[model samples]
Target: MSEETAARRQRPRTLRQRLQHFMRVRFWRMDIAADAWIAPTASLDRNWPRGIHVGENCVIDEWAIVLSHDYTRGLYRDTVIGPRSVIGTRAIVMPGVRIGADCRVEPGTVVSRDLVDGEHVAGHPARKVGSS
Candidate 1:
């Protein structure tokens, strides 16, 4: 066995740490909070583990894409989806956007900027559509 692999196996681990490690290694780097659900058809960035954080009670629907890295300049930024937020089908949340709590992103929306709490948005460049 490789030395690094053997040493890693020999180290002790707490249950929580082990679980976190498993989740990071096995799933996409989206640090999804408990009770948050991402549909099976959704795609989240695996390249930047520390860049994605999804809060509790959030729902990311089918074919949604949550990106954290910009390939143009190879930039990395944190992306946050706050509690109780909903990202609808085919939505694309761009890198570095902070979506606040209780926000609703409509289908096929492209979120290119930050969204404040309680915002209901839609369209290509996701604009505020109605009162949240």
Candidate 2:
């Protein structure tokens, strides 16, 4: 067998070994606060903090991208997802956005600001569409 091939085979399994590899790779740096649930298929981007502070019982769905830094300007910030909140599939949470407890961010939503507790938001620039 070729030396290069043997070396490749001996390499450690990257955190991103699954179909949704980005999720696991990014999650390695996340804090993932107590009892928070993160789906295996979720795709968390690298423009996030070294650790994610997820409150208890938070459910981050598949393909959700939670960011803690603004890549455009090279500014870093922290993202806080409060307890019991649900982040829907493919939702994008921008840097420094604080999602309050029990909030619901719908699929395909782009959240760029703070969300109050129990708020139900949707759309590109997510707004308070209703109260949960």
Candidate with maximal lDDT: 1
Please give the RMSD of candidate 2 to the true structure: 11.9
lDDT of 2 at 22: 42
Question: Compared with the true structure, what per-residue lDDT tens digits does model 2 show for residues 64-132?
Answer: 988877668987888889987888889998878899988989889999989999999999999788876
Off by over 4 Å in 2: 1-29
Q: How many residue pairs clash (N, CA or C atoms closer than 3 angstroms) in each of the candidate models, in the order given?
A: 0, 1
Model 1 C-alpha lDDT per residue in residues 1-132, reported as the tens digit of each score:
224323433445546545654575467555777556666667778778779888877777779999899989898999899987888899999999999998889999999999999899999988899746
Q: Each prediction's Cα lDDT score?
A: 0.79, 0.73
lDDT of 2 at 83: 82
The C-alpha TM-scores of every prediction are: 0.79, 0.74
For model 1, state the Cα shift of residue 83 in Å.
0.3
